[model samples]
Target: MILESFDRRTIANLEAALERVCDGRPDGADHELRSFIADAMVACAKKGQTTLGALTEAGEAALARRGISDRKQA
Candidate 1:
């Protein structure tokens, strides 16, 4: 998917948003989760969710739909 060209500030914000849920676990072991997040971001962007908050919410909702929890439970 062709994602929108966001400004540096927006890009930084989105990356930070993704990191909150991904937690720096995008190595080989967490490839699937990484892919899910990437795809979700694309989906959100396609739907005009360019803001960090919107993308984050879309990513979480997408993962939740697939029963994949990004939260860390105590």
Candidate 2:
């Protein structure tokens, strides 16, 4: 479906944006930006804007790859 494709693209864009916001700093830069991304993700989830389980799993996997876990707890 066209909507499915759009959702996939939007999810990918959001993930990439989150990655860019997360890519450096031992202390971690940009809390506000990160929070904004998180909020956006939550909003998207609430609106059923994308596949929640897949998006969240992908995000968790990305965090794990970065040597981080418990992203929500972070």
Candidate 3:
């Protein structure tokens, strides 16, 4: 677990995950959506999911739950 304390690596991973998931979104990408992704990453970290892949997956999953698609290349 993260002991509920986030470190540099943890923050970096979450940020990377957020960026990856928000890549296809509009310029602003909607504050609510971004907040949701960030919240998801935090939840995952609190659950001992700190790996970059895991965090990214969690963020992506949050987007999916919001009915958002991976349209990065579209």
| Candidate 3 C-alpha lDDT tens digits along 1-74 | 44358988998898888898899778427888899788989999989999999999998888887663556434
TM-scores of the candidates are: 0.62, 0.34, 0.78
C-alpha lDDT (0 to 100) for residue 54 of candidate 1: 85
How would you encode candidate 2's per-residue C-alpha lDDT over 4-66 as one tens digit per residue? Answer: 535566656556656654677453466754654555554555465455454454444544544
Structure candidate 3, residue pairs in collision? none
Cα error of candidate 1 at position 43, Å: 1.3
**Against the unseen true structure, what C-alpha lDDT does each candidate score?**
0.67, 0.53, 0.84
What C-alpha RMSD separates each model from the true structure?
5.6, 10.1, 5.7
- Give stretches of model 1 more than 4 Å off: 1-10, 24-29, 68-74
TM-score of 1: 0.62
Candidate 1 residues 20-74, lDDT tens each?
A: 6677544423768767776787667666677888888876776676563435441
lDDT winner among the candidates?
Answer: 3
Off by over 4 Å in 2: 1-6, 27-36, 41-74
Worst 10 residues of 1 by lDDT: 65-74
